[model samples]
Target: MAVVVGVLAVAGALVAVTGPAVLRWWRPRPASADLIHGPGMWAALRPVLGVAETERRRTWLHLPVTVGEAGARIVLRLPAGWASGEAGTRAVDAIVTGRLPGEWAAHWCRTVAAPYVEWVRNAAPDRPRELPKSVEWMQTGDPLKIHFGETPEGPAFVHTGTATPHIGVSGETGSGKSSILYIPLVAARLAGWLVTVIDPKQNSLTEADEKSGIRIHSETYECVMAIAEFFVSMMAAEKYNGRKYRGHSGPDSPVGRLLVIDELPSFREYVAAWWKYIIRERGFPPVLVWFQLILMQGRSSNHRVLVGTHQFSLDVFGSTMARDQVGTKMVVGEVSIPSWTVAYGAGAPMVDYDETIPGRGVISLKGRRRKKTLADGRIERAEEIQYAYITPQVSDLLDACPPAPAWWDAGAMAPWITPRDLARADSAAAVKDFLPGGRFAGGREDLTPDTDTDVQLTQGSMPRSEAMSDVSGPGAVSGVGEGLAVADLVEKVGAEGIEEQRYTIAQACAVGIIRKKPGAARQYKSAWIKEGKPFPEGEMIRGNASYTREELESVFGTPEEDADSI
Candidate 1:
C-alpha cells in the first residue's frame, strides 16, 4: 500500500505540469492574450476536459481576456450563415436545463451559440463604397465605409453623408471606439474638408497633431467656445455671402463640408458652452460627433452626430434628441441591463452576445437581430504617424499671395492696417503686379482691363516657362526692373475675394504652404509649384505700363532682369 501511494503521488505531479500535452488533441494549443504572452497549463486542460473532442475554442482572445464562461458547452461544425440564421433560432431553442444556473445559461448562449450569428453576418455580401475615402484613425490604410439599412425608424442610408444624422455604437472599454474616429477624419482630409476636433479627453486628437488636413484643439471652455463660434460664424457667413460652389470658386473660397468631435460627453460636461454653440450654430456643412456617451437636445439642419457609449439605458438617454435623432443604435456585448430594451425602440426583443469573441461588437439593425461580430476582426486602434519635416518646395507655392487677416500677427503687421479689418493691398500698382490675368484693374477677381494691359505683360505667354515664372517671380524675367514691391502686389491681388478667402490665404502662409521673403514688407519671392522648379508660370517683367521691353535696359530703364534678382 505504501509503494502504491508513492507511485500515485509521482503520477499526479506529472499530470499537473504535462497534462496539457496529453490533452492537446482535445484542447487548442498555445493561446495568447495581448497583456500576457502565453496561457497556463491548467487553463488549457480545464477546457479540454470540460469540452468533448468535437468542441473547439470558439473565439480568439486578445485583450480583456478572461477565464471560460460558466456551464457553456462548446459544439463543433454548427450549420452557419444566412441559411443558419432561421435554422439557428429553431435548432438552439432549448430551455435552460435545471442543472445549470440562469446566469450560467445566459453566458453559455453568448459563448457557444453566438458564433452562428456571427457567421450569418460574415456570409452577407459586401456593400459598395459610399464615400470617396473612408476616414481611418488607425495607421492601417483602411477607410470607414458609411453604410445604411432599412428599418421602421426610417431608412438607414437617409443620413449617409450629412451630420444632421446621428448613430450610436456602444461597447465595453477597448472595444474599438477610438479606432473608429480615424476613418471619417481620413475621408475628410482626402476630400479637402477641414475638421474641428473637440477632445476633452487629451488622447482623442493625439493622432491628428502633425497630420496635413485637419485642425485639432484641446482646452477647457475658452478655446472650445472660440472654435464653436468660428464654425458658427463661417456657416452664417457662407449663407450671408450666398457663396455657392457655382462650379467655380476661383481657387480661393471657403468650402467646408465636415466637422468631427471625439469624446463628446466629457466635452459637453466640461465645455458645455462650446457644445451648445456648436449645435445651435450648425452652419458648418455636417458634423461627425463621437463620444463614450451623448445626451444632446438641440438639432440643426446642417449637422449630424455619431455617439458611442458603453451604457445602453433610457435614463442616460436623457433628451428627446436621443430617441428622435438616433437613427441607428448599435449595442455591443450580452444583454446585461434591462434598460437597453427601451433604447432599442418599441417592442424590440433583447438578444445575447458572446463576450469571449474578439472584435465582436453588437450592432442593432432595425429589426434587432442577435448581437454579433464584424466580418473583419474588432477594429484595431492604430498608432499615430509622425511628420517631422516640411520641405522647401511646399514653402514657395504659398509665397505668391497674401495670407488671411486672422493669421497675420497684428504686432508684426502693425505698420500695415487695422487688426480688425486687415486689407491685402497697401499700394495701387501692387495690384497690377500680382493678380493673374492682370496688369488690368480690379485685381484677379475682375474682368476689367487697364491702359497698362498694352505693356508686354510681366508674365510671358509660354505655358511651362510662364507658369514657372508665375511661381518663381519677376527676378528671372528678362528686362525686369528692380524695386517692384512683389509683397504689396500679392496683397493687393489677394483682396478681391470674400473674407474667408483672405483668411485662408493668411492661414496657408502661416502654416507654411507658401514662403515669404524676410526683411522685406510683404515681398513675393517664389511659389512652390514643384520641387526644384519654382514659379514655372511666369516672371515679373518690370516694364512700366508704357514701355514694352525691347532690348531690356532700354525699355525698362533697369540694367538686366538678373541684375534685379532679390
Candidate 2:
C-alpha cells in the first residue's frame, strides 16, 4: 500500500506540471475553418460561383485556411473540367457584394500552376497613416527606394534600378506630387548625388531648394542651359570612360546624376525654341533625343530622369519611344480609367477611382520580378502605396551639402541667337571673345552687318578682346576699360593669393568693394586706385559697374604680399 501511494504521488506531480499547457494548447479562441469555410460562407458562395451541387462535390477543392490576428484566407482549387477564370471572377463579384455573413473581400485570384481563388474575410485593416522617421539612401548596385505608401504587408516602397531607369509620376495639382518628388530628391542628396531640378511651376520645389539646398531651375533659359551642360558633361565623361560609363562613386566616375523635370508638359512648351536650335539648326536630335539617350545608356552610367506631369498620355510624352522608355509608372490621386490604362497598360488590377486618397496611388515596375527561391517569382506589378513626408531632420540633412556651382546663371548662352549663329560665331572667334572667362557673358554680341567680320563687340561699345586684355595689363588699376570678368580678376590676383586672404566675391560685394550687375549672367563692377583705401560700410551704388584693379588689391591685398603672409 505504501508503494502504490508513492506511485500515485508521482503521477499527480506530472499532471500538475503539464495540465495548464495542455489545456492552453487545446483551447481554441478561433479557427480559420470556422471563419472562412463555415457553412454560411459556403452557402452564400455556392450559387454566386455557379457551382452545381454535383460539380461542387466532384471538382471544388478546399485547401487549408490561413488564420491571422484580424481575419482568415480561404483558397479553393477548381477541377480540370471547370473554367477557373469565370468562376474566380464571379466569386470575387459576390464577395464584394457582401454575400458572405461577415465582411469579405477578394484579395487576389491568380491562375498559376493550378487554378485557384483566394478570398479574405476581414483579413486585415487599412495600413496606419504614418510617415517615415528618416530617409534612407540606397547603396551602390542597390535598387532605388521611394517610400510611396502603406500596405497590408507594411510600408510600400517603389524601387527602380538600371533595368528600371526612368519613372513616370502623374497626379493632379494638389495630389501630393511634391511629397512623392521630395522623398526621392532627399534620398538622392543623402546618397551624395548631383540632383538637377527643372521646376517650371517654380512653386513645386521651392521648399526643397530653400531648406534642402537643392538646385531648382525656374526659368526656361535656365532649364535649357542646365540640361545642356549636364548632357555635355555626361557625354564627355562617357567618352573618357571609353564610351562605357561605369557607375561608381569615385573622382572620375563621380556620384550619380538625377534630373527631375517637374511638370514636363510646361517644360516642353519652353523647350520648343531650344529644340529648334539644337535639332533643326544644329542637325542634332531634339531634346527628347537626349532624354532617350539617357534612358537607354544612362542606366549603366547612374544617370536617371523622373518626369512628373498632371496627365499620363502618349501625346504628353511626345513619342512612343520616349513614353515606352520609362520603366516605372506611378499614378496618384483620382485618375480616370483611360489615363490609368495608359499609365499601367492592360491587365492592371481594378482600382476604385471613386475612392480617392491624397497620397494613395498605384505603382508598377515593368519587367521586374521579386527574387524568390521556389517556383517562378511573382512579377513586380502595380500596387497601392502611401508616400512619406519630408521631416525637419531630413531637411537639415539636405542643407548640409556643400554649395554647388551657380551653373544655371554661369554657363547660359544668349536665348535670342540660334545654335547655327552661335556655332559660326564660335568658329569666327567671336564667341570666345564675347565670353572671355569660359562662362556666361550676359551682354549681347554686336554683330556687324558684314557677316565675315571676326571681331564681335558688346552693346557697351567695347571690343571683347580689348576689355579682357585691359584687365590683364598694368593700367587695370586706373580702370582703363569696362568692368573685368571675375575669372580675369582671379587670374590677375592669382588664385593662391585670393585663397590666402580667404576672400570671395560675395564678401567683396558685402564690404562695398565690388558691385553686382543685373542680368541673366553674373558680373561684378568696381573702381580701383593705385593705393589701397577703405570704402564706407553702408555705401550702395548701381550703374554700368566697373571694378579697378586697385579695388581688388585693397579688398584682397597684394597677391605677392598675401602669398608671403600665407
lDDT of 2 by residue, 92-122 (tens): 5564335344555554434466666666666
By lDDT, the best candidate is: 2
* TM-score of every model versus the real structure: 0.34, 0.51
Residue 136, candidate 2: C-alpha displacement in angstroms: 11
lDDT of 2: 0.51
Q: What are the Cα lDDT values of the candidates? A: 0.33, 0.51
Top model by TM-score, which number? 2
- In candidate 1, stretches whose alpha carbon ends up further than 4 angstroms from where it belongs are 1-159, 162-164, 230-234, 237-256, 272-304, 312-318, 333-335, 364-566
